[model samples]
Target chain A: MKKLSLAEHSVRELNSALHDPQAMDGGTEWYVSDPDGRHALACGLNDELQVTIDGHAGYYCAGMNQHATVVVNGTVGVGVAENMMSGLVRVRGNASQSAGATGHGGLLVIEGNASARCGISMKGIDIVVGGDVGHMSAFMGQAGRLVVCGDAGEAFGDSIYEARLYVRGQVESLGADCIEKPMRDEHREELRGLLAHAGMDFDPSEFRRYGSARELYNFHVDNAGIEQGDSHE
Target chain B: MCGIVGLYLKDPSLEPRLGELFEPMLLAMADRGPDSAGFAIYGDEVPSDQLKFTLQSAEPGYDWEGLVTAMERDLGGQLDWFRNATAVVIKTDSGEERVREWLAGNAPAVSLMSVGHSIEILKGVGHPRLVADRFSLSGMQGSHIIGHTRMATESAVSMEGSHPFTTGLDLCLVHNGSLSNHNRLRLELERQGMTFETENDSEVAAAYLTWKLREGETLTQALESAIQDLDGFYTFTIGTRDGFAVLRDPIACKPAVLAETDAYVAMASEYRALARLPGISGARVWEPEPGRVYVWENAQQASEETGT
Candidate 1:
């Protein structure tokens, strides 16, 4: 096990050491203490290493991970696990905005509430929140799945595309072109697997699925005519 | 982008260390806004019968004592004054309107930063750390304080463009986002006889709040109207004589984190600002909801209220 204290080491030194093959080959397990809400800790990891942050982190913690698993014992700031290609990042406490934003592939589990724009613009990430999510949770999400075990804030998924959303609690409102869909047996099975993997005990049958209505995939001719008329005027 | 930080002590025992605890929070946001910085401290309030005014001058070695002597001669009262860098704080029994009229006529080079019993605002065009040090912010003793670090998105990087703008007596505001409809609102507010000191959008916000309060709206009511009347992205931390309040726009594109312990309630643009506070590890931390008003007041008894 490798131990790192953020109090004594800069984030650059810690990230550089994590990136070095010689330094990482000695141990796959890493411990980071006293993160003190510093930004961009343990980012851009490609190897299959297990890293744990013992305290709260600042923005973009563990971002762009390819094959590593990172866990934060406390809350995280904005854009945690943003644009990750693969691997897992779990947060034991609440998360600020845009968690798992624009990620291509990853499994990000937040055991506490996630604020606005969780899974925003995500491509293939799977996010499971143990608590409520703020407004615009999955705004413009191109593809992937977001599971919320607690209540969701306003505009659950705004202008979404192809992404599936499962919530076990009440949704304040849904965004444009997003509607609640039927919960099929396959979806239940998928939720079951995700919940089991994330170590959540909730039953899959209690969740409802939401997805895009596909109405915004193309521009309407009526709107084009209206635009032409307005331009002529 | 800009950064806003506020600390309101619920436990009166922490009042003496208010500036010491808030300095790091403001410093942590240096990267967010490197152009200019300011802070408003609610401390050492004068008696209710008197008022305190914070004034600043850009000229080097400005005659603050001479200005105080002139004010004393005109207002017919002894004015106690102190200086911090280029700024001077004066306590007087004169009327606010009379003092303004006197300053406008006699002190053309000086600018009124704030006028209240408790609030004293100090801001300048420089890094936040330097501004904090210049004002001896870490040594300030207060019940609450709000600070802003400006990146100069909608306004120039001048002393007048900096934040912690005074809204009314014992009230100041620091903002973290730009206002889009400030020009129109400024016109409307000017028509209502509200004066403005800068072209900065945040000053417009402060003036708007002042107008609302003058029209008999409560602070929460004024902020609720701000959500409708103001157009832009903003996360504002307002420091009042009693305590402080936090509000975010409906879209909430700008980030705001709030943490509360038994001792104090802290709001910062990011968690990094609050991470170093004592008992922060045990604080009940969360994000303030969008378009909601969260106020922590220490009047008579400490109380927190959330309103939408």
Candidate 2:
């Protein structure tokens, strides 16, 4: 595995040098150093590359990526893997807002808490946050799977379209049009698979599922009775 | 795809710090819209009651100077100075709308916009430094400023299309997202005898809000009306002479994030954009509710002054 240290180079230089396939012989590994907490360290990559940042990073660290498996050993800034088409991004520490935003396809796993608007407007990304998520998580989410192991803040999944939210811990409340659905046998298996993908050991049965009931999507005068939704037992 | 930023403060204590905080925020958004940038800084003068008109005209051949001189003679103000290719800061002893009307009649060819305690606008095409140099942005002392960098997707690439556009006295708008119902609104405003300079949706929004506000409606009412009336993806950071307001479309098609500290209130299209500004470490940041409009007045202004 080849190791590429990003400490010495600017983001633009590092990206330009890494864009060529010949420079990266099969399956390259880069160990970034002296990161000094720079933003957009490894953004806009589509190569089959394995890049790791040694320290914390600023916003959109691996945004709009494809066919890359990027890892941040420390905290990550906002929009991690934003609009990523495919591949994987793992953050060992907390992530900021709009993580995996508008991603068409990808597996984003954050080991720590995520800030507000996490996975917002997410299209087809599968995000697994190990810790609590801030308010408005998955707001206006179109299509994706967001699994939160810890507590979720208020207004989760507001105006959400088709994304599925699975929370193993407490949820403050669900946003408009979002409802808690029973974790039936099929959902349990699905959760188990997603958890395994993120290398999580949590039991699937312990988690609850939340989704849009499709009730508020089509507005009705009588629908006023359906205010907010909760998923705690 | 560049950045836009604004600052409005009533406390004179924070006035000097406005440029210091705003410069970095504008730098952060360089990647979003790097083409051209400018800012309209508004300031309150000590014991002052004067209407200031900062007008930017097209290239010199358009006869804007003659019109400005006539309007200045008519409105009873002196032309402070002319800078670069466009900006002319004028001071008038007359009322705000009176100056506006005089400028409208005399400078029919010039696209006039304003910001601050009275009204001022600074804009040009190119990088921030390029536009800043053209307008001498750093020297303007104001209580607040609203700025924009153009990506030119929906609007023509010209000085008139730049942001911080004014609809009436002391009102300006800097927008990040596109307005869906801009065409309909523009036609409606034009029918009401309002002139539009550019095809950009943001201009229509500026005109719409200004028209609504001038008609005795509050900022909140104009925003609520925008939510009910405006269509498509948009997020606007609007600054008036008195305060600033932010509004997102009901669906929130565009992105906008806000952070508020006890000392200051800041907002931007992205969190990364705001991170570049000072005093963000302890600030509590969050996305505004979709379909909701949030208005933040100058920290020193009363709640009633917000006109929300």
Candidate 3:
């Protein structure tokens, strides 16, 4: 067990200390204080360490993480746990835009709302937001599971591909190529596991599943007007 | 990349220190926008019967004195003036159309930054710090303020290209991202008799909002309509005499953060800009949801609203 105050050491110093395998010889449990919404804190930790951030943090706080379990007690700014390969990152408070953006592997959970672009371009990550997830979430997602306990914003999961989206509340609008799918036995079982891992108590049967329609995966030249946005291609 | 910061104080005790609190928030995003920067502060309310006009000139050494004297003589009205670095605030008991027409017909060399009872806009090219210092922004006072640092993704890097564009009577808008269909929207707005001040994409948005308000749309309705009407990546923070608001495009690619305490509500491009605010640690901070209109109005004005 260890304790480091961000007031005494810069975020870089604390991260470097966490990165050094020898420096963490006493134990893998470290507590960080006075984060005060600074960027890149507790990022890129690979070992099976437990990192507890005492306060708010800024962009990419637990980015590119693997194996480590990081907890933020307060709100987090943009791109929290961005591009994580594997790990568990938890925010006890709300998360800003693009939470867990483009992460390949990991589980990121927010106890409060997540703003726009939550889980965007996620290759393989399970994201659970206790509150609403904002618009354009899961945009162009390749593969993953995004579970929302509250409303999902406009154009949720636009231009999607092979990712699963589950929402318990209303969805403002679904993006192109993303369509609501029936939550079957397999999806319920998988969602049950995800909710359990995130320590959320919601019933899997309460949610509805959404995923790619697979219509745009192999576009036929004959099918015109598929790209229907105002922008000219 | 661009940076936007807004401060709306619910606690009157903090009004006098608006500039000192807002200076760092603007400069923190210096890297986000290197081309130009600007801000609109709601301060120095004129007499209720009077109109205030913030006037500026392209030439630094332009004879503001001679022009003011001549205008006073010609308009046959007493005009009190306060000169800051970026522009001059002129308070006069004059009609809005008459003043604008007078300025247009007489003082073509002078440009109007804003025309309201209590707003002053100051902006210029360079670092936010330099711009703030040049205008002595840290010494001003107001109920609310909104600022922008531009990266010049579209228009040329001139003062007109800078943000916190003022279009309506006392309203101003600062943007974070570029609009994709501004050309078409601009044309449509121009045909409706809304004039433009610059080729900047953001100006079109400002004009659009002003036009909507003129057409009897409430501020909330105008912002909601923006999400449907405008196409592009954008997050707009609009400032009015008694209110301030935040809105984003449906697919909110632009970044914005908000924090609120008993004393104030603050918004910025990132949390770091808001980190230094007083009593922020205990404030309720959250990311503003996309396609939602978040507005903070003066209590008196808010209570005056008749219906939803």
Candidate 3 per-residue lDDT, tens place, B1-308, comes to 99999999999999999999998888888888867889999977888889898888878887778877877887877689878865888889866888889899988878788889888887888888888888988888989999998898888888878988988789999999999899999999999999898888999999999999999988877887788789899989999888888887655688888888889989998888887789988998887766778877882223212111
Q: What DockQ was computed for model 3? A: 0.62
**lDDT, model 3:** 0.87
Q: Order the numbered candidates by TM-score, best leading.
A: 1, 3, 2
Return whichever of 2 and 3 wins on DockQ. Answer: 3
TM-score of 2: 0.69
lDDT of 3 by residue, A140-170 (tens): 9899899999999878999998889999999
RMSD of each: 3.6, 8.8, 5.2
Error of 3 at B157 (Å): 1.2
Docking tier of model 2: it is: incorrect
Instruction: Flag clash pairs in model 1.
Output: none
DockQ agreement of candidate 2 with the native complex: 0.13
Instruction: Give lDDT tens digits, candidate 1, residues A1-233.
Output: 99999999999999998888875677799999999899999999988999999999999999999899999999999999999999999999999999999999979999999999999998989999999998898999888889999999988889998899999999999999999999999999999999998889999999999999878844354555455447664
Assess the local accuracy of residue A231 in candidate 3 as a C-alpha lDDT between 0 and 100.
Answer: 68
Give the residue spans of candidate 1 off by over 4 A: A218-233, B299-308
The model with the greater lDDT, 1 or 3, is 1
Candidate 3 pairs with clashing backbones: none
> What is the descending lDDT order?
1, 3, 2
TM-score of 3: 0.88
